[model samples]
Target chain A: MTNTEFIKSLSEKTGMTAEQLEPMVAQFIGAFARELASGRVVSVQGFGNFESREKAERKMYNPTTKSYKIIPKKVTLNFKMSATLKDKINS
Target chain B: MSDKVTLQSVAESFSRACGVPKKVAEQLARAFFDTVVDGLSNDESVKIDGLGTFRVVEVASRESINVTNGERIVIAGYKKVNFIPEDGLLVSNLVSDMPDVREDVVADDEETDVSNDTDETDIEETSEVDDETEDVSEDITTSEDEEPIDAVEAEVNMVEVPEKVEVQEDEFSGIDMLICTPESVEEIRLELEQARADAERKLIAAKEAHREVLRLEALLDKMEKSMVPECAEEEQTPETEAEPVPAMVAESVAKENLTIYEDIPSVAKEESAVETADEGQKAEEVAQTPVEPVEESLETVETPSVVETAEDENVTVNLEATTEEPSSEQEESTDVAPAEEDTKSAAEEAVQSTDAEVKQEDVTAEGAEENKDAQAEALNRLLSDKSAATPEPVRKKKDDGHYWIWILTPILVILIFGVSVVMYKAHSDKEKTELKQLPVEPKNHATPVKKQAPVVKPKVETDSIQSNTNVPAETTATEPAKSKAADNKSTAKPKTYILQRDETLTKVSRKFYGTKDSVRAIIRANKFKDPDNVPYGTEVILP
Candidate 1:
């Protein structure tokens, strides 16, 4: 399901208009991102956890050029599904 | 920000952002995730507009061995959820801000000259970690208050968010690792200890190598200094170019005596044989002339001294005399073949003896003195014989030789003296540069030692963090005292100042000493248990 389809279903279930739900969805995402940006694990009940993980810097060798390049450290968001959500999805 | 942001916190934030009722926002948050899960289960993927794509990837079954049992097994595969963040998100651009964060962390580490005590360092690390977390929380609150109203503003805020997050992550990278897995701290400590030990060993080896180079250079200087005098003595001997042959022969014989005295006896015997053969050849060539008997008697007299001295001067002098008398040139050419053969045999014997006996410097010196005496007697005999044979021609040739010698000797001496002075200047310059470098190397070594102190500080910081986590208030209280001691030390050595309201030891140290390390010394001097929290009007000494 794409974002529009998911939002349409959510608006229908909540009995809200797409216009009202669209802004609310944006607000929700903004809040979620803000929490994650603070280095907190955002845990949605029965869904999964969203956390930022650090990837250490590493050296990469280019065989063709015979030279080395340093890939700088990075912060990547990781998502691990809760066990209940995993069981629900698999079933 | 709390340690964990549950669904409730997200709803709370969402409600505050949209100015909606808390209950309605809570319901919306629940429904939002529920819809995402349902969408994933039905479509195997869910694409959120601003967030990212969530996909259920299929894993293929494969054969594998059980780790414990070491038996082959057909493993089952299942679906796994994967998240791919949108390209426009702040998290995707986190790497772009990493260099700045790294610079800040490195600068902080360099400025703080942490104590060697493991406990103190650990406490400092924990405090640093706490400070970083608080900074992140403060950033979050400020960002939320300045929440973006449109996509462009959100994008701008997104850029700001990641930069703050990156800084926090870099600042507490090691601390986070320690806190995440306690066991890895000890492992990291062991690795650090090994690295420190290796660095120290390498430093010692470098110092020893430097000393050896200096010693070798000094020996070369001594050898050069000794050679200058010998060159001066050679310059003092005023010989014409033709007579230089005899002077060269004398020098070579002196060198041979100095180097290989043990072979002198055999060399002398060979010299005697060569002289006899050369004289016989000369006598045969001179038989057609009236001077054959006189030349024959002169050769017989020269042969014994040639054997005793083992010097080439007699042969050279005879060759010079033959050259002056053109009739003997043909005889000299014929005599050269036998002379070469005899010298070759003597050289081979000398080489063999040299291999046998390599020592006895004192005996070589005595042999050189005796050889010099024999050379003087041989020279006197040759001069008397030449005078008796052709007195007028010998005197005329001597006058010409003395005039050339007088013209060339001073120029040669001056040139040689200038060369020696230049060489001495160069040697002295090199010694001066080396002396300067010797002092500088210790300072270079000292810098690395200071750097190593910071390296060891982190380990202790981790230790203190672990042990003092339960008594955070106490640690915080003690931290000020430590920083005050560092501050007082700086003041005692340098200047004095009154502490202002809201000013801490670190700020004062940075202002006065350009480093936060002096905070501990100031704290020690003031004897404050909590110097950072001290009264506003307290007087602090600066060093």
Candidate 2:
């Protein structure tokens, strides 16, 4: 769904305007990103969990070029769906 | 953040960030998630900027086995929510925070950077300090140069300071290069020289051992040949006497000496002859009836001893008498000779004694026959004992041969193994020296022409040492000396290295040139098919 439609739906549910909810949503996302970046698991009770996982550096071979390149280490954000959310989506 | 951050913490943080009431912030956070879930459920996907895309992917129905039972089952298709973070938002934040989370990994990168920075700073600081010292010295000189006489000394002092600094810089660069390459090369060369010396020593010891074994074998062969003739001489008398006695005795003794004489005719010949003569005289006195039998026995025994003695004395005369016996026996009768003469005489005496005692005692004749039979049995027993004694020497000779064979086999095997070990060591040493020389050759070539003269001297010295240690490796040694002379005029030659455990082509190249840029050159020079997975201890040539 588009960000506006989602924000519009969130504002309606919270009895707040989209303009007010937009800043609140931004703050919420920033906090979530900050929590995940800090290597903590962020759990939204009925929704899902967000976590950061470390990816180690690895060598990659390009067969066409006949060359090897080392891919740098990185950290990636991962999401795991809560059982309740999974059931809700399936149902 | 806590180990687990719940929606309440997010709301609290959001409230702290936006100056909203806690309850309002909590409501907004709850509403935000609720809307995202609603969007996901309706549209099957949701894209949140600065967050991520939440896509509901349809998983296909597939066959599976029940874990608890041996039964096939199918899993019904369902949607799985997959989250993909927005480009650079989460990653950038996580990466920025990564140093705090994982310090060890970051420390490595930092250490390398710190080392390089420290090196540059150290050089700059030294130069700055030198400059400061120069300035201080110049000021002191200027202060001292109030006298015209001291002014010339100040100029000399001024000239000396910059020269010292320049010389120190040159020393630093030279020390750095020595630390990087030349010292390791020298250490490897020393190791190679030590190994070559050890291998040459082993080769010398092995060659000495081989020569010793050869000398021992030659001595053994000479001893064996010398012994063979003596053995043959000792065995000859018994063999010849045994051969004719059996033939003569078998015909005349009526099988009386058949078993005994056949086994040991040579041993009993003389003894049997004397016993038969005495018995013949007894038969002559008893009745003269058994005289013929006694005489026949006498002649049979006497012929072998006489023939053996004659053959021992003169082989040609024995052979002539043997051929003359059948023809001349009747002309010279009653006297026992060595062949048919003895038989004919015995027959004539039997005729004469039978005519003389034809009517004398019959009982005495029977008794003499019984006595002859008994004596023959005793001679057979004695002959059996002699036959048993004869082969013991032969068996001993055979056992000696076997013993020698057993002794020599292990020595030969040990010689083979030792020689092989020495050869293998020499081969390995040659390769090691060659590999070691490759690096030195390149260094020599890389050096300026003026330094080449000194480098050539060491090469010649090593070659002379090789020649002194191993004559066979002299050719190989001289080739390198010649090549080193040629290398003085050429570009740097490729050096060879055996990759150590956990070492790679890049590591070798880095070791040679202080940079990994020459890895491609090394691989090309060596024609490495698999540059990434080269086995350890593989010889690589560094260009």
lDDT per residue, candidate 1, B91-139, as tens digits?
A: 4223345356446544433322121132234334433533443212222
Q: Share of real contacts kept by model 1? A: 0.56
Alpha-carbon runs more than 4 Å astray in model 1: B92-543
Q: Can you write out model 2's per-residue Cα lDDT over B1-543, one digit (the tens) per residue?
A: 348889899778767766788999888888788877887787467877667788888889999999999699999998878998887555434536434424532443344334334433533443343354321122222222223223323433443344356445434422322221243246345434544554454344334334433443443344335434543453354322333333234223422432333234356556466655554564456434544463434334334333444333333333334345422322221111222222222322323334323222122233333433333333222222122122222122112222345556667999999999999999999999999988777766542432343557865544433332342222232334334433331222235566777777876665444457778988888898888999987888756
| i-RMS for every candidate | 7.0, 10.3
Query: What are the lDDT figures for the candidates, one per model?
Result: 0.51, 0.52
User: Which pairs, if any, clash in model 2?
Assistant: none
DockQ of each: 0.23, 0.26
Q: What C-alpha lDDT does candidate 2 achieve relative to the native structure?
A: 0.52
